[model samples]
Target: MINLRQAVFYEYVDDGVVEIFDRYKWGLRRLGVNFSQDLLETIVYCPHNLENTFMAFCSWVLWLKSKGEKTNPEILSETLMQALKSDRGWIPYDYQKDFLAQHLDILESPQLSLWKAAGQQLGERLRNRIISDISEEGKINFHPNSILTDEEKEKIEAFKVYIDQLYL
Candidate 1:
């Protein structure tokens, strides 16, 4: 099994974010003088907010403008699609879509209570795993792999006798 910490923190390191940035740079290069350092940095460090999304879209437009390419929504859409497709594994599209859809208008709705309740339930589940608090029923659930074979049980019995003899 993969170490949970390593899996969770994979995106924060140089090997992860740097590699994705390098690929985006390459795609921009193909379009000529394609990306700016500021733009790259903003994309790397910006929070996933509407303002930052708009900034990223503007950066793409600027890059296209520099290349004498048409600056339109289609161009921005194509660039974003390319960026997403090239880094699908690192960037989970489905989760992003769902989170954005759910939270984008959360401040405007009375359904915030429902969202809070759901979040609380998820928090409790995570807490249970961290504390390793198993119920009485859980203790009754024996792992088959941990069971001793007949031969192993006999050896254990012999070892018990050997210890008993030392006391005698």
Candidate 2:
């Protein structure tokens, strides 16, 4: 069986996954083989099996790290969607979607701040929906299909302006 802890750690790296690579690099290195190059290549080329390939790569890296092998830290996934996006060069679309759906909430939360932050980073459209969702008492929802109404859009714009003024 694959080691989940290690897999998760590697997933973090593979996705560029976050800003914690340096913090976790040493731990990953302690696991095993230098699959950084291979893993990175796979991620860039094999879009179809991105999740599985990533999971397997993470598992192997973790296993190797635990064994005191010389593994390079190179796994990363920016977001669930980015990880699951279909790549014409590899695997398949359905597989990526399925994998993303399976682990949709690895680091997500229902907090409005978190959603708002994500929305801000993602763009105004996303931020608007996030605000609307929060206003509607649907903060627990994380699906991409979630949307905001026209009123919510105005609210988001107003909020953005308010925030910008603070910076200015």
Best-fitting candidate, scored by lDDT: 2
Write one digit per residue (lDDT tens) for candidate 1, span 55-84: 243354444565688644445545654443
Candidate 2, residue 161: lDDT: 66
Q: List the residue pairs that clash in candidate 1.
A: none
TM-score, prediction 2: 0.23
Q: Write the per-residue lDDT of candidate 2 for residues 39-150, one digit (tens) a residue.
A: 4343334446543534443453344445687633233332222444545322334644454445433223324344656465546666554543442222333345656678
lDDT of each: 0.39, 0.42
